[model samples]
Target: MRTHDWFSRKKDCDDKGDPEAVFNVLDSMLKDSLERLKNMRESIPLENVGFDSCTLEAVNSRHATLFGCLCSEGKWKTALWLRRKLIQKGAVLDVFAHNLLLNGLCKIRDMERPDCLIREMLEMGPPPNLVTYNTFIKAHCLKNNVDKALYLFSTMATDGIRPNRVTCNTLVHALCKKGLVDDAKKLLCETLSDDKEKTNSDLITSTILMDCYFRSGDTVQALGFWDQMLHKNIQIDLVAYNVLIHGLCLGQHINVAYGNFAEILKRGFIPDCFTFNTLISALCKEGKVEEACHIHDVMLKMGVAPDKISYKMIIQGLCFRGDLVKAIEFLNCLLEKSLMPEPLIWNLIIDGYGRCGDLGNALSVNNHMLSLGVAPNVFTFNALILAQIKGGNNVRAYSLKKEMLLNGLFPDLVTYNMLISAACISGHIAFALDLYDEMLRKGIEPDIITYTELIRGYCMRGNVKEAEKLSTKMRRSGSQIDHVPCKILIKKYCHLGEHDMAFHLYQNWLMREK
Candidate 1:
């Protein structure tokens, strides 16, 4: 509804005897007004924008609920305004209302206001409770301010509010993320020791430590944690199994990881996309594309739908094996499934065909990609350019460079290097020099490949003096003078019967090596 219509409807709300109904209308009106004001980019006070004396008077007793409604909807600014208005009228907000406001503020990382509110709660009647401390602790942990979170944790005990599993879990996850796994372990141990039911280390905490150890490459320690969970009779969940599978895969324990996958199915725990993708990625990396494809087929047969990752991994596996025919089949399958493949997926096939010297299929894929509305990116153009260069079609390669510019994509270092190399090979020394000047203008630094290409181009034109000067410039620019350009110059010097100059060049290279 329009903002003005809300104001008009607010007038009819008083005739409704239900105070709850009147407050609901007021909440809806305020929400719509806030949205309108946001879209208009207006900075007017929310009170003036929506609420007025009549509306406030009508819902005076329902201030706390209204405040909660606003905060819950993430309209914190409007909520804060209503809160201040309520406070100005001497309304006593209870601990629940205060906690709601604290939650809202903490979610937005508005630390300053929450600090003041916590102080007010401490000094006033409704002291902060466990929920209040947890909210602040969680907020600090999310910001990676573990020190502050710990301080709040210590104060919780002084306030006679014990830190529960949620509090400890937050800190534990934060510590693990910061790579302070040892500290995390110590904290978990201390918290568990303090618990009267010392055996109550839940699956979440155990899985977190296991995942941490796995990521840190301490497979032994990670497995120890897993064994500990099993010993404690903890009901292992799907997330914990996925972590083990991923960690095992990372550690190259693919056999054991697959063993666990089988165990997951045997235990009636259905594997999800992550489970299949992890195995597929591992098998593909190990050059077991067939095994990975088998896993993909098994996923389909089991009625577990493969996601984008599933399709990408399988297609990438096929492409890496140079199985372009199977890769295209999978691509068509992806299209039939109505899953729009990303540009990376298309680039993989294009690059695969390019590597096999099949420029025809590569260009066909590029055209098909464009028709499907997936605009070619830099990598897309690079693959095609490299293919053109490899096929000895320098003109087509340079044309692709121009196409890249028209598509709003700047030619990157690889693009320039390939084009420069191709120009030198085709004896287009002047054109190669022009490309070098363009590189300098575009601020693309010339690396070893670039300088080598340009030096070779000058040597091809028999401009040995210019080639020598470029060699000096290349060294000054910090590109290591590789043997390719040096040998080129030496050959040119010998061809001109300048044996003395060639010997001098060799002597200087030897001296620089020293």
Candidate 2:
């Protein structure tokens, strides 16, 4: 019914003997439907739209594109509904169409529909292709249902559908993600030995295993696999080069990673931001800031504009190396380049300044962030509060806490903990207790750290009985209370000449441990 205009427009143009007008109107209608296919498919009649072969082909092509978009957006139910509409309209939902639906079901983890669709595909005559089985297999693998995935793999041979590179890649990547790199390696060898032509899949599998091995801190095997990949002449791509470099860097084999970077450039492949970031991160992590900076300069000279991630990594590297001044300088440089530092970058720089005992500079950074209209979150507030506390200005910290509340920012665990600890340290037991009550009223679950700080405050006030009550609550809070606080309490009791009470508490603790 919605397509009535399309037909009427075509007929009117045809009657006027304007063939060009007819074609233009039909083309425009098809384009409009393509843009809103998700909406059009439900309302438009596919069976008797009075379209020729060319327009009909356009409809089918648009349907295919629409199916892909739906799957990508995870609208599995709508995609299924569209399939039913097509079938009811007597549109021949081809093998590719069915496969797209199957992929959608797999993506949404709709187990029952996928099985039904597979069964229907088997009965309806267009046999399931390798892509169909691969989708199902990859889905099961991702869900950690590896047994089902393997079963599907085994059944592929019986169904006479040969598994391809994508199939192998899916299974291998899943195994690696589950930290079963050894199992992945075994599968890789078995598959490659059975089918020698799966070289591309082998490259992907090898890269996955290399990254996994590095993550598990097994540098020997990671490098060995890298060597094996090269010896086999697998025609490594830029992606493969990047993976090996990252793995080698993660394993602290920066020299080898650098060598691989040189090899990548020599092979006429342009290194991406990932390549430079990986190398820079590795160098910075090793406290080789000079080398990292040199690489940063080289990256700029190579015409690859450093992104936010690149700057963040360098800033973090500088922070870790105790170069807060340089970190702030870099932040200023980023601002000068019209690159507004992200909240995370600002947080890191603020924290770096705090660590270097420059509370003034930290607060200065916070103020700069505010002036730029970058609304500070709890992390920003917490950092500033922490700097104030560290600078022995608890009053300023409290004022910031008030300012944070005025701005409607809910204080998280760290915020409360910092405030509580600072209050206890300054012997403001009453204020600490009030903050604790406020934290509870806000539904923020207090951890052992909170309890320990409160207990210490009570003990400092010579209120051992109140401290004991807090200790009992700490034990029941499902948080691990460290023995340091218990030791402190024991020392307090001994100082009070209450040795019997101290011994009783120690015996109770021993009994609980047993």
lDDT of each: 0.86, 0.84
Give the range of the ten consecutive residues with the poorest summed lDDT in model 2. Answer: 10-19
Query: Over the stretch 135-230, how does candidate 1's per-residue lDDT look in tens digits?
Result: 999998888899999999888878888787778888999999889999988887787546544444478888888899999899999999999889
In terms of lDDT, the best-performing candidate is: 1
lDDT accuracy of residue 280 in candidate 1: 92
lDDT of 2: 0.84
Please provide the root mean square deviation of candidate 1 (C-alpha atoms, Å): 12.1
Q: Each model's TM-score?
A: 0.79, 0.74
List model 2 lDDT by residue over 400-420, tens digit each: 888888999878999999999
Report model 1's TM-score to 2 decimal places: 0.79
Residue runs of model 2 more than 4 Å from their true location after superposition: 1-82, 104-115, 189-197, 333-340, 355-360, 371-373, 391-393, 406-408, 440-514
